[model samples]
Target: MSQTLTSDQKDALQEVTNIAMGQAASTLATILSTFVTISVPRINIPEVSEIGSAISKMVGNGKEVTAVRQSFAGHLRGEAIIIYGQEGCRDLADLMGYDEDIDQSAERELLLDIANVLIGACLNGIADILQTGLTFAPPSIMAERVIINSLIDPTQLTWNNALLVEVNFTLEARNFSCHLVTLMPEDSIERLKQAIDTFMENF
Candidate 1:
């Protein structure tokens, strides 16, 4: 029987995210010089439909619904989505020195910049730690009403055809929230364990 990745997988995953997240934090810190620190939240595989409400609750009581979807694909192909209600995004944009009268084009431009900083840092973190390099396929903006099943293709990535291990971050100072979906391929599940086992053996 194949060994399942236990809660210990979460701990290991946290360490992996920690390293990448720290790098991401540093990059953001340099850009804004705001001392960014990403929190290590528990990973979740909630239903796709639940994401809107889940994220809304996280940002809480914002009049305008603002969500920016940025997707990155490579060896590990998936999305790194940033979401907030409209009010929250406007407030964040204003705080970040962006003006009002925001439209799709303007918003798209800003979102892409954020995704680049984040996804670049995120990929760098993974590559350095895994001792392998990962290439990006460019980020595309995701629609606000994306259904969960849209991205899950059994043929492309098989960790599971069902759900993704999602990590959410809330920027404490600016109250801007972002989510990272680290997709697991079904076939690669075993490979991850083997890698971890190798890592365990070293420790």
Candidate 2:
């Protein structure tokens, strides 16, 4: 697997992710009825084995997290893992019209709902820009209040390399935040390069 991306390729992927992130933020904002803010989407090309450590660093320390894992396939194929800090999950639950007292079922429902919206919108945005069709599997709760290292099992890697798109989201009103990490397979790199080439030629 290629360990790095060319400058132009990185630029093209970042542009694609930024556009996707913007659309995701809009969708989340509309869902919660509040303004949502997203940071610049960042890309990381890491071996499948190192993804756990990468996620740990992005999630920081002393925070328990839960993740919803969803897979998408089309021109690109990979998983979208949305990790929410436990405290942030409670805030999000409240924002979504759930009661302040959240039980296990409520939390699960909240996580799945938010994950479906954010992951679905972002992936669709990428598919639209790349002009590729994509279908998603129903999302499932991967981990609950677990450490990042345990959230992903290396044994489940379907590919050798991963394109990690790190997007940080914040709801200003509730002071809630979460990290949405989209892991695209090795083939996505080649597909993205071709799409970018076509996109540039058409411009």
User: Candidate 2's residue-wise lDDT over 69-120, tens digit each?
Assistant: 9998888888888888888887887777777666789779768988998788
lDDT of 1 by residue, 35-146 (tens): 5656774454434345444444443433333344444444454445444344445655675666666575766666666667666776556545455566666666654433
Assess each prediction's global lDDT (C-alpha) against the native.
0.52, 0.77
The C-alpha stretches of model 2 lying farther than 4 A from their native spots are: 97-100
- For model 1, the superposed segments whose C-alpha errors exceed 4 Å read 1-4, 45-88, 144-172
Question: TM-score, each model?
Answer: 0.68, 0.86
Q: State the weakest 10-residue window (summed lDDT) of model 1.
A: 158-167
* Index of the highest-TM-score prediction: 2
Top lDDT: which candidate number? Answer: 2
